[model samples]
Target: MREVAFITQNKEKWLNFEQAIFHRRFKDPDELATLYIHIINDLSYAQTYYPKSRVIAYLNQLAAKAFQSIYRTRRQDTNRLLYFFRTEVPLTVYQHRRYFAYAFTLFFIFVAIGVVSAAHDDTFVRLILGDGYVNMTLDNIKNGDPVAVYKSGSNWGSFIGITLNNIYVSMRAFVYGIFGGLGTGWILLQNGIMLGAFQYMFHAEGVLWESVRGIWIHGAMEIFSIVVTGAAGFILGAGILFPKTYSRKTSFKMAFKDGIRILLSTIPFFIAAGFLEGFVTRYAGVMPDMAALIIILGTLGFISYYYLIYPFIIHRKTVNSL
Candidate 1:
């Protein structure tokens, strides 16, 4: 990015800030403060890249004027929980959205490896899924219900067990980032391979459709949450790998906090996934096709919207709100 290009790109925003500050175009300090943060960021960039640039003085002037307006009308925000989900997560996720793409790309590659391996090798699925589980599923398939495994436990018992396991898996993805995200990638590889192998086994047995409704009744959100948490893990690792302007220790602390918040955001979705797996998936084999499809699509849509699409929407709204 050349200095001229940078100035050209940000000129409109700078002009907006200038008008807001000099002409009293914005009385709301919250909005002005938000604009101030943008100006300060640009000032920092100008100072770093072009130490003697005239743009720094202009940005500094805008920042200094906005500072007084901020404190004069600043009000404490009371709805911490609401803000965390509604504003904080969206902004943070948007900032690191590329990590999600990385995680998902890895997920697809690993899953494809699993599928190809299982397709070519008769025993590869068993190697990944283990003999006992494979044999049990085969037995269920023979009995005309390929997914009868879901019916083994009481609903509440299964829900509690599955939810705990999900939370544990999510935290593992986050904690493993201490190892520079390789640990999280390893976890994703293992799980992705297993999922691919599991699905292919049913396809090879001519029960792919039977498995789809039952498995995806909950797997939609469950799988999405895992990938998301894995992205959080990468975010955690990135702080250590590329600390940029901050010290490594400070970066680690910041990434850890942000990663934990991202992990926390997945809990409700995990619980919902667990509830579906325990209570709904067990009946998917017997439920009406329309009903099963609705649940599957609904869960998938809701989770996908939140993690994939909503972040950008919120980000655009926040930036354009100025």
Candidate 2:
């Protein structure tokens, strides 16, 4: 097709992709994949037909972004891979995938510092959780109701309340990125450190295994959502930091919109996690070990298939059909 003919024919598609990537919700994985193809085609066409055009160069950069999204979604395959992707790689991408090595290096260094400090100091968890919470938890444990905090209400009521609250927290974290991304960074740091400290507290009490079996039934998905929310915040903050071709204001707006959409996508995950925490975790004392194991394994299995296995299957099927 002639350059203009292709441009004219794809004008709608181009606009759709542009809006989806820069404006629409990020949850519709299919739209994201479709946009990837459109962007790749547009950039290749521009290079072939209008190499010197500034417009072509700009679109090419956006196309690169589309490709990176594909890579991010693609890596979320196996449970092991999904664990890494959901927890680690997405955060790195938030900082710019190009800097993943540096970001991870710094992350591990900080984690090590946290681990070492906690190892030496019995008071580290207190510092992280605060004396009030430690005392409250100790009081609960002494009363023969270690996890009573989660068992205080009707299961369904707690489920709805907690789910809604978690979603709001995640959305706020993303929206707060308007404060020049510091808000997002602070949220991530505080949560990450608290998680580590929480785990350490259980370990110190010689209940780490019990804690993992009981808590991760819900914590796995809930915590993953938190990380993804952080990614959304990063997306918003990134626009402000590196506007690249567009005016800073325009880039910031685009990023903020996308970030909100990313946060919106986590609603269902939060709901499910909340249900498990409220109903299931609260009854861990009476629930079968096999049931909790199944729940944890099943959730991880779903994440593995949707993110990692499905993509490879699609790619291979397409190759074979061709």
Candidate 3:
């Protein structure tokens, strides 16, 4: 592609990205993600497709300037949340897959920790879960209803509480990026170990599959939200660790902004997960087999669609456009 042609082809997208970043009251996640993808693609194309061209150098400079502009002033409004969901969240998921090795290593470490601790001492549950929560859960278990903790509160109240709590957890996960992302990894490790230990306890009680079917209805989304949160933290931390051409502060600021944007996108997912856990999870025994299956499958579908399918579609569309 010639310089003028390439510039013309992307002119509309660039303009939209600029206006969305500056003029619009709120930026759309879809638009913002699209812009991000475009800028990266432009740079990649310039470096690979026309490395020696003066146009390549000029475009690189242009992209750098544009990135700086957006970095300086992050316009957040109502559309901010919407754009985050449509673009930011999906991209985070996609980006995290590149670190599947890290995630798997963490998973194995947490699982081993749970197994080793459980095998060595019966009090491992207390270590994994706080003493107070463990005692409360044990009491609940002894009361002839192990899952009674999920049975409290009306549906609406539970929905609000769970959603808010989950979002708070996610935001905290992102905030931990300030520690150069080690804090983020700790959050993931802690959560993963708790999950492993919690499930192991259920297994000891001879209700592993039952708990899986019931709890995972919401956990699928809830856990995925955490993974995305961790990914966002990693992005921030990665920027801090490897600033490339930008100054440490500039890169860190940009990463933090993008990370939070990704975090913002997951609010609805957390709310839905909370609702499922609070309302639907309580009625696992009463919920029809088909309905339960549908909910579980639906949650999986949402995750797969956003994380895997949508990213592929967007990548192909952008590449084909160029």
Candidate 4:
């Protein structure tokens, strides 16, 4: 069937299913389960025949919602927390993939801006990274240990401090969405610029590779989590900016629900990043090149797959199994 015809045929049923799930006044677990089966059947058909159509994604969202509602009416046979992390977060992240794209795009663009600006203006690095940090790093470079900053604090103290600071940064990235996402964008811009300038400073001092080996040991997870948090912020902002078919208040509430879930998913990642920064990144300069490379790629690959790739896998598997 043509995509348009398929959507036209099932669209009303999908909308009704959505309404039935959203309104608590009319919830019936058994009845919703019946409707959910129908929705999944349609979703599987859409997946097989209309694989490229947006309808697949739309149906997937409905299927997820319906499944949540149906489960709400029943006792859990499985661990709810495991199900939430393993399934729910991935599905919701898939639905908001565009926000991820937007956040990363803005961050990279600003990073480029920082690189270019700093390359031409020596003072730009000082301005973004602060004079004290610039001076300290320069001194460390002279001492033949550019990453010595990470070694200054005790490992346990650094891990605790870094983890707390990471959480604070992520919360700000998420909470700023109330201003319509621009605040989150600003945070991304600032961080991106600082990163770019900081790296360029190393390059100018003939230690680009030296810096990468140590910095990326933990920088991989730390930076990726921030970008993901920024996406969550965008999700929050999107609700306020585009309240289609729902009141502004209702839309904001829905956005907050999903946004917070996205934020919650990053907690473990932030902790991992902090541990690496405190205990590992400091030794990047002296550690074996192969070992440092593994840590960097391993952390980067793990988080990237979770947020960027795993969602489709779970969503597709859930739809097809039904």
Candidate 2 CA-lDDT value? 0.66
Candidates 3 and 4, the one with greater lDDT? 4
For candidate 4, which ten residues in a row score worst on lDDT?
68-77
lDDT of 2 by residue, 1-322 (tens): 6767867887787667766665654676566876766666777777888887665756755664554454445554567644443433333233243222332333344445556667779899789888998888778666755565677889999899989888877887777677766776677666666777777776677666666777778877886676667667766777888786678999887676556655655677898899998888888756788887898888767654533354445434322322
Better of 1 and 3 by lDDT: 1
Worst 10 residues of 3 by lDDT: 64-73
TM-score of each: 0.81, 0.66, 0.71, 0.86
Off by over 4 Å in 2: 1-60, 64-114, 139-145, 303-322
Q: Model 3 off-target regions past 4 Å?
A: 1-84, 88-108, 135-144
Q: Which candidate number has the best lDDT? A: 4
Clash count for candidate 1 is: 0
Query: What lDDT score goes with residue 237 in model 3?
Result: 84
Ranking by lDDT: 4, 1, 3, 2
| TM value for model 1 | 0.81
> In candidate 2, how many Å is residue 80 off?
32
lDDT for model 4 comes to: 0.86
**For residues 1-322, what per-residue lDDT tens digits would candidate 1 score against the true structure?**
8999999999999988878865678867777877888897899899999998888756764664454345335424577787677666766677677888999999988989889999999999999999999999999999999999999989999999999999999999888988999999998999899999999999999999889989999999999899999999998999899765447996788688778889999999999999998888998877998999998899999988888899888656644544
Backbone collision tally, model 4: 0
List the global CA lDDT of all models: 0.85, 0.66, 0.70, 0.86
